[model samples]
Target: MIGGCAPIDAGGSGGGGSDGGARGDGGGSTGVNPLDNPKGTERGLGVIKSAKDLAEAIKIIEKVPTKGRGPKTGYDRDEFGYAWADNAEEIPLAHNGCDTRNDILARDGEKLKYRSGSNCVLVSMTLDDPYTSKTIEWTKQDASEVQIDHVMPLSYDWQMGASRWSRSKRVQIANDPLNLMPVDGSANSSKGDSGPATWLPPAKGIRCSYVVRFAQVALKYDLPVTAPDKDAMLTQCR
Candidate 1:
């Protein structure tokens, strides 16, 4: 849950390479090439349209093993950690005073506005949403308009083998920037823990990027995906 309702600090350039803009097909200004931001420390999920890069994305997807999605029994959002907790250890931007949600907001959004006297609390910003290829000007009043998505949704993580991981490990994956993106709220809600096999971004240009991020998350945690998910991921690039 968000706290601290205060005046915004006005616009400023945010970290995370958002200033690079959407350097991909179609004309818009948001996102960066996923290949360039391999560690996931940067901002925005850029489109991958090059034939050579698409092939590379395919190879990355192929490296992940396949498995049937396990039952969602006893799964809860709290299993990983509290909502946007900043205490998650070993993940980028964690323990950085700002919560995960705000950290990503500053990372991905441009012309960032922070809460009064605090650089860590985001009050407003503009975004070029990769999932829908649209621009959004957002503020605290309608916070839900932008939601941070787990590239590999948490429940999907449990089904993929995170259930067996220790609490700290789970927290790490949960808060890791590499596994997260701020995107259109409705699109994120529609995803609902579904894998690539069942869902992809509405923006065709970003589909390959979405799956590449999924594969990266999977490979990072040594997690496997459902066979169909892997196949669908491969199909995105080709």
Candidate 2:
């Protein structure tokens, strides 16, 4: 039951998943509630303006278990299944016929143009990226301009407790929209596997919302962050 939106009935159907992360059209201009967008289907991570909302976000972050990251032994992208697989179980927008990347693009993009005769391939669109606070006019030809970021990177997850998770669960998190975001390619690349302690979105205004999203993913998967990471996350909302 997401907090801010209408009740999401179970077993709703949608198109294929895309590796592209979440995007926005400023639909949530007044501020989007993370509680309401539990499935990450919403356009953006809205600002947490009210004291009550900030406190609620802090409470969620505080609940996450803290631990130091572990070894990277046997870590690989394939460990979580293929990138943007549409069949990952126990996630929104799975097996809808499109890959996860395209699904996200379609979900958050504006003025979208799909490939001829195919609604699945998003050829171009405008993205209001939250990470860098920039609007990107993205096309398939310059696809790397926008990259899908795992809120909790796969390597970070490997170090955290996902090493013990079943392959299916790993795949689920890897493709889950709640754990992904579409941002500037450079920013996403710079964030490779970094926790909040070390990396944050360049956009100061979105930092709080970014950490809240991180906490959301951590809580959903029963994952832990390092003490420093947790502290950093808390500071954003404070």
Q: Give the TM-score of each candidate.
A: 0.90, 0.87
lDDT tens digits, residue span 1-238, model 2: 2112222222122211221233332322322456667789766555565687778879989999998899999999999999999889979877777888987777666667888877578899877777776878899999999999998899999999999999999999999989878788999999999999999988776677789889999999999999999999999989
The reply for model 2, stretches above 4 Å from the true place, is 1-31
Please report, as a residue range, the 10-residue window in candidate 2 with the lowest summed lDDT.
11-20
Give all candidates' CA lDDT scores: 0.82, 0.78
- Give the Å error, residue 103, model 2: 0.5
**How does model 2 fare in lDDT?**
0.78
Candidate 1: tens digits of C-alpha lDDT, residues 132-162? 8778899989999999999999999998899
Candidate 1's C-alpha runs over 4 A off are: 1-25
Backbone clashes in model 1: 0
